[model samples]
Target: MAKTRRVSEEIVCAAIRKRKKRTHVPEADAPKAGEPRSFVIRRGKYAPMLKDLEKDLRQMMMPNTAKELKESRKNVLKDFVQVAGPLGVTHFLMLSATQRAGYLHVAKTPRGPTLTLRVLEYSLMRDVQSAQQRPRCPQTMWHGPPLVVLNNFTGSEHLKLAATTFQNLFPAINVATTKLSTCQRVLLLDHDRASGRIRLRQYSIVVQPSGVTKNLKALLGRRAVPDLGECKDVSEFLTRSGYGSESEGDDPDTTRVELAEDLGKGNQKARQSRIRLHEVGPRLEMELIKVQDGLCEGNVLFHAYIQKDPAEIAERKSKEDEREALRRQRRAEQEENVRKKESEAKRRRRPQDDARGAKRPRPEGRVPWG
Candidate 1:
């Protein structure tokens, strides 16, 4: 946990340092000849309105930076030294209290009671697990009951997986309730952590976006996962046999159509046309079991509480959200890949389309033959 905290502090420091240099216009402050000339921040003349930009940037970077950045640099230093909530002490301790006091620090705080901190030699440790997580953040262990699966053998597997994913993403989901993808990304981070971290561990297997989550209230209402094992994550177990139908060489369009037919109902055939809970359920369960089993086989961490520290929790949640968003964005991008492949397959399967396509008249300068 301490290491995780340390990792978090380092990350924050790096981000602040990075944001500090985010939009630096070295040109704005560079010396044309010899003197480091100071010029009034010229709005719209020599540079983009830097003062406002800096203010806006600080607002996001600085703690609750909505108001005027009335804090002197000295305040930041003081906060670091005395009221070092999460930031370290020495980084702000070895300082001249007089010369460089600026808006950074609100006010000089009396130093806390002295305590010794022994610096240790640092070495890189490699993680070999399969879970996903931030570069290295705390784990969010969801100590909950095992998932319910009275439906089928596949149901047990997927329910467990969905349960783990539910637990893994619970925090992220809370933070980004309005955004499902963000929560999903956080869950994946847990998977990465599962396979990698030595100190912090994560669960394996990632659940698909099933009604498992969107209808969590209903599931919990019905008392899901009554006899769940004392497992950290459900990874080591069986994963859904294959990812999607195509990974198993099943046609997705055919799968979708078959699914629609299986759930056919009277009066509103179109209503059941899209993907259904039953259609996606079996696949979801398989993934759950695979991931759960993986975790059970000593590939998981058993901290129970993923992250207890509020600061770490907040930071990790932010990371989970950011990571998931990227994953979804990447998935969206991958959809383009799926479409490209599908398009090519269509071109191949229906050479007639290609022939017909070639025969179409060109609209000057388009596709050679638009």
Candidate 2:
């Protein structure tokens, strides 16, 4: 039998010549559902599949939806608590429906775009200038007309907020629009020409309104009516009376920290958790936390999950590395000194040739007669 011929270089070169992209067998080119079909790449055309794949990827990654849900279910307290830290009970306890929606969305919840209990306008309504012309607040089912409520709430300047708000700010049943609080119903500005002094006088507003008969007492006192808290879709803010500037104050950045903690500690143990491993600074910044973000999950576990005080950690690490370098430099210096001593000793043991070390000293080496 004739021996098998060896493949020649020209034949091998022709075989190795680049083929058209279409002919090249791709690893896996199965078109998934909702994917576009592959196209012919001719005349050095750019690969169309890459753009499609990239577009598909972009459509796939939603920035916050999943993360928000995972975070909010547990981190709700951390978020609200940090909010509460700055606001008073009245301000903190209450949030308008719109505001509440914003908070939930900020915390990454999908409460909105569903049942939009949007509060058009929310505040104390104090005036009913005319029966014909009255301010109407759209939110009537729960709050009635704010003017009526303000009539019930607005007391003289000196009186405490709680006492005045309950007495004057109480809603009147005569909100024909169920929107405007008529002046008689909410505003308590009574003028008397009989006493001719241009002065504003304080009125008697009661805090412990015991023994007084209210127009709505029958409905209010009834146990079946349920507290305002139980009112469906009612904002807790409408119930509270007063607020102050001190409600907003210097507060720590507890949102990120608490959120990280709650998700880690609660019953839901995500794939990763943030736990303190060591302390770096005066605050709890140095302690290592297992970052829950998807990007940090794989190779970065041992790399130190640092979100806070990064500058400080970097500076400290830099100093440490520098110290090590300095130590190494000192060690090298000592080694050089030892080598020098050895060389000097060897030089001392070696004999020197004569005629003053051969062909006389160089002129540059000679010293002038002093």
Candidate 3:
């Protein structure tokens, strides 16, 4: 027998590095339209549900966002913001919980217009998968960002801003240049005007050849030979109507689409395909609580419940200004003290230098000429 080949550690590591280089998207190669990178993080103590939700959010913002970002209680918003600029991260999705409710803070990096949303209800991915009979979550589904669909997010100024923020979270797609195969997922944000809440749902996009019986589709799959043990003939097997077949009474207008390109094995160009959406969850019902002028803080631009009069707003502004001035004065005083201490240390060092240079009284016995 031939000797078994042994791969050295260095060779394995080099191969891994090479693979990473090929897969990694460098900042220089990013599209001119600017693809937004994000950090989906949780702050403080959180329930298991919220932690899972954070993971699902990270998965939804795939290819560009950090999927396995670790954060501790000691880490602050500023720490992530400081690092985001260098790494080209543009958005932050921070989840936090209190005794009353859970909150999601969506903020643009290093700046203002943070949207605070209260989570009314949520369902994790595991929960949704377990409930479905056939959960479809292929690994290829996460290779690209989901297509965002915003419904009924118009009319109000706050709604418009919220819509814009959600749109900016993902890279824009050019229909002419974009390939159909890359669109593996869909993110739906439906705003309920009556309830004043937004429903978030993520789905995996699947295309199947339309106008084909289930038996024919299975035969084309070729993964395994269908068991024809009970059938009398091959024709009977192929023309079987109700043998382990799903309901196919779906509306043609809503589900059918013309394939612009060859998407997969059975989905060929110009072929009629049926589009189906499988909910891959972390579903949420959220209400916009407030929109702030800064990252997680600063003046509130919009509040759902509370309304402050102009006088109260002016007073608050004045108080903020006064506090800022006080902080500036204290910083200036600290700098002045630091400068004075440096000068004092220099003066002390000069006297020490003089003492060292006294020259030992010029050696009392030595003549001045010598």
Candidate 4:
């Protein structure tokens, strides 16, 4: 009996240990100090805007624009970034329909953060292992569940679509809509006519700014306020039109009280003030994710906490170190090669010098030594 009791206690302890291991850690519940507070913002109205933007972008890529496409894309992306938050463009992948499974776009932000977006368009129904087909970012590992966003649907339809997409993309991962404190993954889904398949995509949002800025001065010229002060309308119109009485009127009419206020003075002050006011662009940092093609509409996108893993950081550092080491090795080898070439050239010339000896003119008094 005592042996059985001892065995039961052991089993109980093992069970407790197993349960502890299975418990999940909610890492992304709160934004880090420097991290932007992530909100699952959604609005379906932005779908049309996305569609139009896609059309314009496609038109720009037609022909003779391969060279200019990069700049054009940045500009286009800038506009998209501006409208994304209001128009709810966070879930659409900003790639063309022809983009393959592993295409990526990177935009630099003026405030020193990089916006990197990638497309992973593979199928879970395939015979291959899902992980093998899953798209991967080199140094990034999303360590939390994502917020799931449903577009063009609401009420029961929204819930249904979210469920269906979640199952299709993340089959085994269990997520709860009510208990959302432990999630950090974002899943965006939309119907794709090009492929005729409901496209499922996963995207993450970290607040970042688009570095490109519209140079107000460059666009509108150095002078923001028009020089109307000196033009005919303000300078000579009243005088030329005889609106102003002659400065020295023949009859000193006291009936019209001499107006003490200068009418043009206020206009001048207003013009100067307008000129002094600098035209600055919007400063709000945009957090937008672009899915190549489709519409994402809903009041709530995916919501999940996000956190960085120490392992991933260590791995990235190791990779950088490896690259630095390789560069040093290559530089050392290059230096060695240069030295070897110089030494070989000197050695080759040394024999030639001996053969040639000193080619000085023989003294007139001295015969050849031979």
Among the numbered candidates, top TM-score falls to: 3
lDDT of 4 by residue, 229-346 (tens): 6656633533444233433223223222222222232222112111111111111111223321113211122222343377965786688689889999999999999999999999
lDDT of 4 at 336: 100
lDDT of 2 at 147: 30
Models, CA RMSD each: 33.6, 31.8, 5.7, 33.2
The digit string of per-residue lDDT tens for model 3 on 1-370 reads 1333344666777887775667777554343446788899988676444787888888778877888788877888789988999888999998899888999989987886899999999998889999999999998887777899999999998899999999989999899988888898999999999999999999999888887767666676667777889999988887777544644556658788889988654778998889999999979999998998889889998999999999999999999999999999999999999999999999989999998888765778889999
| lDDT value for model 3 | 0.86
Candidate lDDT (C-alpha), each: 0.28, 0.27, 0.86, 0.35
lDDT of 3 at 178: 89
What is the TM-score ranking, best to worst?
A: 3, 4, 1, 2
Lowest lDDT block of 10, candidate 1 = 278-287
Q: Which stretches of candidate 3 lie over 4 Å from their true place?
A: 1-33, 46-49, 224-237, 240-250, 328-370
Using lDDT as the measure, which candidate wins? Answer: 3
Name the regions of candidate 4 deviating beyond 4 angstroms.
1-113, 117-266, 270-307, 360-370
lDDT of 2 by residue, 290-309 (tens): 21112112122112224446
lDDT of 1 by residue, 128-239 (tens): 2113243322121112111222222223343334333323211221333232111111111112223221111122222222212223322233434633264344331122
Give me the displacement of residue 259 in model 3, in angstroms.
Answer: 1.3
Clashing pairs in 3: none
Model 3 earns a TM-score of 0.78
